[model samples]
Target: MTTTPMPVLEELSAAEALRLMAGVPVGRVVFTEGALPAIRPVHFVLDDGGIVFRIVGAQRLADGLHNTVVAFQTDEYQADRGDGWTVTATGHATRITDQDEIARLARQLPLPWSDRGHMFRIEPELVTGRRLTR
Candidate 1:
């Protein structure tokens, strides 16, 4: 007879969570729209202790929602091995309009997938993550 080892579920430290987040370029940004919870997938970069990404100026996301409280989440999972991790960061998001900062971020962001050109930043106030492994 044989028994499979139990999988371990672990909570990653905040630093580790942030480090993991830095490596991921895609995530969901959660927010409230018309009093309803909403989420949008976006490409992002970790910079200056914040998450920065761009959207076209005409997008709904580019509407007057600066300084809104929001959440950003990223995760990876393997169904076959049941091994994966998830990271989430919550904070207030603000539009970054400084030309100099935008230029700096332009160098860091992946090639734009959309046509609009508004940039925003989120300074995470809380970060948490979990990992599962055998």
Candidate 2:
């Protein structure tokens, strides 16, 4: 008997992925804790090649929401060809401490979610993506 191995996702073009992610309004934010990984869906935006969002007292935020590298991904799927694409942005997150900068960023990117969420930013070092092109 022969066995087949699962194929890993091949990387997509950064530009294409960014375009898709920019158009989307939400994504999954992934992080690590001890030997386990945790992920949560979040509303986000892309600005100046970075990801930004607000979270309201979530455990993920309480655990560690600053200066840590995390992965952010967004994707969409259709019935045909199982057509879909995903973009992952790996970056460091930090609380926006500067009032002026916060105000500026706020104007460009408003927080559409609840008011309880605090402003956080992720500056991505490497952004890659993949899509099912049939």
Candidate 3:
């Protein structure tokens, strides 16, 4: 019997990681809630090397994220070919309170969610990624 070869894992550069991140629309945001770790899936867009997303007002996740260090991750997999990549960005997230800026992002990103949600931008301080290939 012939054996299948193992997939190769490769590290991606910061620019490449961001490029890959921009290709996906949904990602997970990790933060703290009630002194414990909490993660939520969010629809996001990559802009100027930062991750931008939305959350409804007065949410525990939103309240905890402002000016806070958090991790955002996104990945894609192809099971038939055994190839995929995952990118994680760690940074401080800031709520977009500027009406003009929020308006611009609203015009640009057009997130498929409630319009009343607040906008947040995560300026990635550390970005890392790995790719698996057959």
Candidate 4:
């Protein structure tokens, strides 16, 4: 039997990574709470230099009580061929308390997968991405 060739991996530029992230509807958010790490899958919309999302309740990370530095990751990968890209954005997360801004973002972003009452925004200081090519 013939074997498939090894896949090559490449790093994506910050702009390209952001573009890829905007095209997808879902991703995972990682943060630290106390001495442990936590991760949550979330839906987001890109806005200027920040990414915005909505949540239902106090998730500790979103409640403005835990660590502010977090990483938001989005990717699309094919298991069979191992071809696709993954983008991770590191930044500070803060809940949007302004009613007007919330209204504006609500109109721009797609409806969240879950029932969420609060909106949050994260301004990424660094963004990195990687892709596998077959």
RMSD of each: 2.5, 4.6, 1.7, 2.1
TM-score of each: 0.87, 0.79, 0.91, 0.88
What is the per-residue lDDT of model 3 for residues 1-134, given as tens digits with 9 covering 90 to 100? 97878889999999999999988878998988779998888788787877888876477667788999999999999988879999999999999989888777776665455266878999999999999997
TM-score of 1: 0.87
Each prediction's whole-model lDDT (CA): 0.84, 0.76, 0.86, 0.81
Show the colliding residue pairs in model 1. 56-116
lDDT of 4 by residue, 1-134 (tens): 98988889999999999999999998887877666887777778888889887765566545652238889999998887769999999988888878888888888766554236667788999999998999
What residue runs in model 4 are displaced by over 4 Å at the alpha carbon? 64-67, 112-115
On TM-score, who's better, 1 or 4?
Answer: 4
Quote model 3's TM-score: 0.91
Question: Mind giving the per-residue lDDT tens digits that candidate 1 earns over 16-51?
Answer: 998888887798888887778988888888887999
Worst 10 residues of 4 by lDDT: 58-67
User: Least accurate stretch of 10 residues (summed lDDT) in model 2?
Assistant: 108-117
